[model samples]
Target: MKPLHARYPFMAGAREAVQEASVDLAEVVATDEDVVERALERVEWALTDGTVGDTRRQTRVELLSYPVARVIVSTVDEHICTRKYAQAEAASAHERFVEELETETELRSTRQQHLSLDALLAEFDLGTAVRETGDGFRVTVGTYLELAADQWGDEWRLVNRSLVDGEVPVDREELYVLLKQAIRHRVVDGLPLSVPDVIAENLDEEVERVRETLSNMDLTTEIDTVVPDLFPPCMKHLLDQVQKGEHLAHHSRFAIAAFLTNIGMTTDEIVQLFEVNPGFGEEMTRYQVDHIRGDTSPTQYSAPACATMQSYGDCVNKDDICEDEINESHPMSYYEHRVEEADDDELTDWREGAGEDGDDDSDESPD
Candidate 1:
């Protein structure tokens, strides 16, 4: 396998490279310990860290592990796992490509290994759909609509963009953002592969390990109810912003969505709460929410850290609990601390007054 294949295993060229090698996947799974271990790490790290972990020095091992990892995820046959694995691969590729573009140099130690921006665009059949402009690049409106998700933030909304002659213009950074979506689309395409019986039998132990880890990470049953009273100050601020029908940037939306999901709010409940937002699309919102909660995919997301919230300017209305050094490190921990200290009467469910009439003074969603 080539170095580029190792760096970007999702690219079409990499797929061709693998095919040409004619590697025996079954034998590799059974005998090649390094390939198997790397494959397992790919799934585990994707599940836990949203990364594919470090790039191995061995190009061959790294390239081979991509397919093996796919087999393992497919064997698990869990939608959430498949989604998480695919997204993690794409996210990792994006980071590397961004670095390469910024520095205008190869990220790999091997010379002439990194792909150029033009190469990347062509590999994905985007050459015709995207074109360069004086300020930056413009993507055909149809392609833009296909790749951009409104839930990504208000910025990705078509109305917020500069449209000219059936094309939408984007700066270098914005184009990369779109590329990330494309990469994700490519990685997720044809996932949960129909693994041969031989390969499946050989990977039983590795599959079991991943399944066990997935079981521990399941969030659906972990949170039973949403308690706004116990929410961290930052989360409270975010929830309040959403309730007011204000626009949240992508990170802010993710922060709030993840916080709510982890706190036990159902997808429908979150959707109802967000209904007040202008241009609300129920289908899109629910899919994004379900994706975050690992309902439709294998990647469950937790709320960002205290530092991340502050970085995005979403951290607001800090309270005494937030000032506590030990208790305020993470939003989840803050909520847990409040829950531990609150009396039964002090802990009220947010759903209590969320009735059809919406008569309650509290911030409740109407039926």
Candidate 2:
């Protein structure tokens, strides 16, 4: 990647400004300058924040994300006290910001990046923005409010009326809080990071060289009971497919059932997942799922290796996570490595606000 100054010129431009103290009204008669420039305090805070590092951080990339996060929410955005910008200008600015994000050299490598919001909302299943304004785009708030009211009652509806009507002004500090969250999210997601085209060709060549080696990574006897929180990318893909009622290849089905079985799912639950398919046969599906769970075999069947999964065209999201973790030949090895990391105090919560035990994991103590 090019230097940060080159990639994000806007961030490079947030230089220190000239500082001068303001005159205090009450103290003006008593003292020449009783006022302090709070800007100086902000500058100091930024400096302190920019330099502080968690010595326990696993990678330098994670440390780098801190400053990038600050830049995304602070250096790059212009704060308006009110929704006073022109609609056309806001749209233009939004477009430019997206282009910058799309081109970010470091984004793809950082981790939680997803399709840009516009791209995601472009699909009708997600629904189109009901009303567009200079301030922001919003989905059909009526539908949301109806659902909220149904779940929480009429008081929830009353509270959301201001939000739907734009009567309640957005608290500026709260906006900053949300902005920081969004910037932090993009950083953690590894948005927009991709290999340079020149290097991408080299990666393809290199991956091809090691592709054959993957076939031998299959596992037979050594299987670990990995928790769902630590499932490898390919396994997660299969789980998602089944949940969506998509057709799974034979190997994919076996791998998924074996995995769910290992993680404590019963034969009936596995069979139920397949019942959504057209022309579903409950008896046949039950038998097949039970067979994979090893009811028919002397020993339990284990999930396939990454190489075998690759042969099934299932290893599409490989970020070389295995190589980064332990260079494990099998997917189970990756799962075990994640489980170890997930046990650590500083690294355990991979899913936002979710605990290893499948409960809400709040940083705060309950009152």
Candidate 3:
């Protein structure tokens, strides 16, 4: 059997009922504290004595199964707000909550199957006298019954006749394979595999076939080119570098993709990078591209770079900031120094100074 969520159409009904009950609870409970208290007491009395109590006794079903009753009492306990006021108003509000809950419960119960093991046993003409053992329930069956039995046996004796030595021997390998198949099946079917017996039985080829059918589909178009023309220029450059024997790290591609994309790198450049970079996987590159295109800020590389520098500060140089100079100091600090040097160079003319080239220095010296 599939999970209730998957097999039973009532799941949708249950969900709808719960939602309706919640709305009703909100509408019934008085907004003021005093009015709410009085209204809750009245609602509680109606639930305990009038509808909920009666239904439980009549149907012999648990209160949890009734969404309306469950909602009202639970809401009272949870202190839901109601809009009613005045003594007359409180009574009216209380009645509305009670009525709503009752309606929801009736709707849900009417839709529910409410089948028990005994009912199923009767349907299959199975005997129920077998007592439960530590492992599971056991029963006796005749040879005649075995011959006529369907896939599911009415009694243990008929089922055991199909098993070796009158008992089923567990196959560990088959069990694992079946379990994996069952999980996949449940995922595709949107079912919860809560029962072990159901999982064990459904974890075979049928489930696998269902899962495969749901999953099998191609969702991509192929563009032919060693370096695709559609790729962004920066990405193409990086790809060229990779193809030329530059050992690009996985994080480097991610970082560069973020940087280029932030600066308006095109899709062609992105595709080219993936094509040329041996370190990059097609799927991984696609994921990065999607991330860049999405609402996330184009700053993925900074954090990882900072983390790397922090953990391995001694591996970098503080003067040049170049990868070669990155040794035993902060690489960012080295890069900053390089920027400072470039700024100084741009501001000054170094060839105009020295000795006789400058007459002002001699004049300033004390004679």
Strongest candidate by lDDT: 1
- Candidate 3 residue lDDT tens string, 33-65: 332333234334432233211122212122122
Give the TM-score of each candidate: 0.63, 0.32, 0.20
| Selected candidate, larger lDDT, 2 vs 3 | 2
Candidates' C-alpha lDDT: 0.80, 0.40, 0.33
Highest TM-score: give the candidate number: 1
Off by over 4 Å in 3: 1-241, 244-250, 293-307, 310-367
Candidate 2's clash total is 13
Model 2: per-residue lDDT, tens digit, 243-295?
A: 67687777777787776666445666456445556544678667766776678
Name the TM-score of candidate 3.
0.20
What global local distance difference test value does model 1 have?
0.80
**Candidate 2 ranges beyond 4 A from true positions:** 1-229, 272-282, 325-327, 344-367
